[model samples]
Target: MSASNHKDTYQATGVFLVLMGILYLLDKWIGFSSHGLPWVMQKDTMLLYAAVIFLWFKSDKSVGIILAGIWLIQNIGLVIALLGQMSAYLLPLALLLVGVILYFISSR
Candidate 1:
């Protein structure tokens, strides 16, 4: 991508982060109930959103994949609880998937 394109991507990401921050602040200060809010609006979803944005807009995707993997690792307990004991296998499966994806991306 050209310099202008990178600049636009950065600007868009900055705007998105700013908007998320504003919403978070509003939720804290105004005591707005977040229960009815969409999953994307939740605080913990920011990293996932950022990862997706980076993967979509940037030429290099490893950072985005790493971020996404980190998010998944951090939320493993929750995932397991939701999916049951069999879900424990998902951790290794996810790691393998990430590794394969990274390998393919890096080989290109």
Candidate 2:
């Protein structure tokens, strides 16, 4: 394949991966009930995923990493809450670690 075609394939794969991740997260958080997609996924979460996918596809690493940190925290908070571990304060600490990692990654 030509160099440009190879790059386009990589970008398309990235977009697909992002979408799949978003769908997985959504399914984990909110199972498909009697209602459909519209009522299943949260608006803010969808928008956040959209931003992540867009930035990633555009090859904007720094902003994508920052947004990914936010997404991780949000999803981890939900999981921790569901497991009744909210009193441990681990969610915030884990988020802090994720933030630090994101900062370091963006700096590079």
Candidate 3:
């Protein structure tokens, strides 16, 4: 690839990795979550970041697939939490949209 293309790709991937790092830190540092919301040590969030790392080292398309899968599952739980009688539905809604947006960008 051209220098510019490589730089652009690196920039994108670097940003993604940084974001994942931030999430991991937040999950570790901030301990505030119930059962439904995506929190630290949770499977969905952990998987998302792990996929990010994997994709960064593996392939972009593969990362996209992993992100999409994680987001899909989170989005479903978010919907259920919001529409159903649940506690603190706001966080899930936010997390759901974030996951969807991230995977959307990754996938396409």
Candidate 4:
């Protein structure tokens, strides 16, 4: 792929990563969840952002592509988990919409 193509994909995935990341942080810090745990700061969840960074650093299609693949997979799982939750319908829908948009943009 051309440099521009890579940049576009990065831009899309980067946006997705940042938005969800902030959402997670806000939910935790603002006491949105009553479970005494921040959803975004979870150990495993942080790996997705780390992978996003790796995707930025990786120039090779193999490594970066693999990271992107994993990122998409993880995002799908996150969307599914969120859908299963008891939160208001709109929030989950918005999250799923973002996830779908991210995956669609990232995969291209």
Candidate 5:
């Protein structure tokens, strides 16, 4: 990658960090309720945002995609709960599918 690309990547990372810090401060000072906030604004969404930034500004996208997939897998239960779905085995089944897919993809 060119120097410009490297600079952009660093700038994006810095901006993300700064924004997260500001959000953290706001949450602390204003006492925002986590349940009342949108899912995107939740603290756990930082990883998703960082993954998006990595995909957008980085030359290589594989790492970003992998991180995003992992985040989805990790939070699948939360997503299902939010959607008002109550399947006891859904989380495990989703995880198993993701694992199989990842295994196949990595073998190529």
Candidate 6:
């Protein structure tokens, strides 16, 4: 397939993922039983969706990677807090790691 076609496919897949996540959240909002951890968080879920959308549109992946990294840290921090293992350093450390990953990905 052509490069354009390949990019289109990725964009389509990203849209699908975001739509699915939104639908799931809407269902939960209406008191549906998700019966488990959400596919995404009630808070900061937009980061993931926006990251996917941005990644599809931009040649540089850093924006998406950074957003996704922040999202992951938020969600995981919530879980860790619940377990009483959360730390003040987690956010900085996670952000640093994400920045490194973004630099490497963008450099390629």
Candidate 4 clash pair list:
none
lDDT of candidate 3 over 6-108, digit per residue (tens):
6655765687678777866776676436444566556666566655555555434555566756766776777566667653675577779978998998998
Clashing pairs in 3: none
Clashing residue pairs in candidate 6 (N, C-alpha, C atoms within 3 angstroms): none
Across residues 12-107, which tens digit of lDDT does each residue of candidate 4 receive?
A: 567657866787778766864575665556544565655665566545445555665666566776656776764457566766987998899899
**Which candidate's lDDT is highest?**
5
Off by over 4 Å in 6: 1-41, 78-108
**What TM-score would candidate 3 get against the native?**
0.37
Evaluated with TM-score, which candidate comes out highest?
1
- In model 3, the runs with Cα more than 4 Å from the true position are 32-35, 39-108
| CA RMSD of each candidate after superposition | 3.7, 7.7, 9.6, 10.3, 4.4, 6.1
CA lDDT, every prediction? 0.74, 0.64, 0.64, 0.65, 0.76, 0.68
What is the lDDT for 106 in model 5? Answer: 94
TM-score of 2: 0.39
Better of 1 and 2 by lDDT: 1
- Estimate candidate 2's alpha-carbon lDDT, on a 0 to 1 scale: 0.64
Tell how far residue 101 is off in model 2, in angstroms.
3.1
Better of 3 and 5 by TM-score: 5
Please give the range of 10 consecutive residues that has the lowest summed lDDT in model 3.
31-40
List the pairs of residues colliding in candidate 1.
Answer: none
Models 1 onward score TM values of 0.61, 0.39, 0.37, 0.32, 0.57, 0.39
For model 2, how does the per-residue alpha-carbon lDDT over 1-108 read when each residue is reduced to its tens digit? 477655754784577567767777768777655347663356557556655665656444555556665675667656666769554786668768878987997999
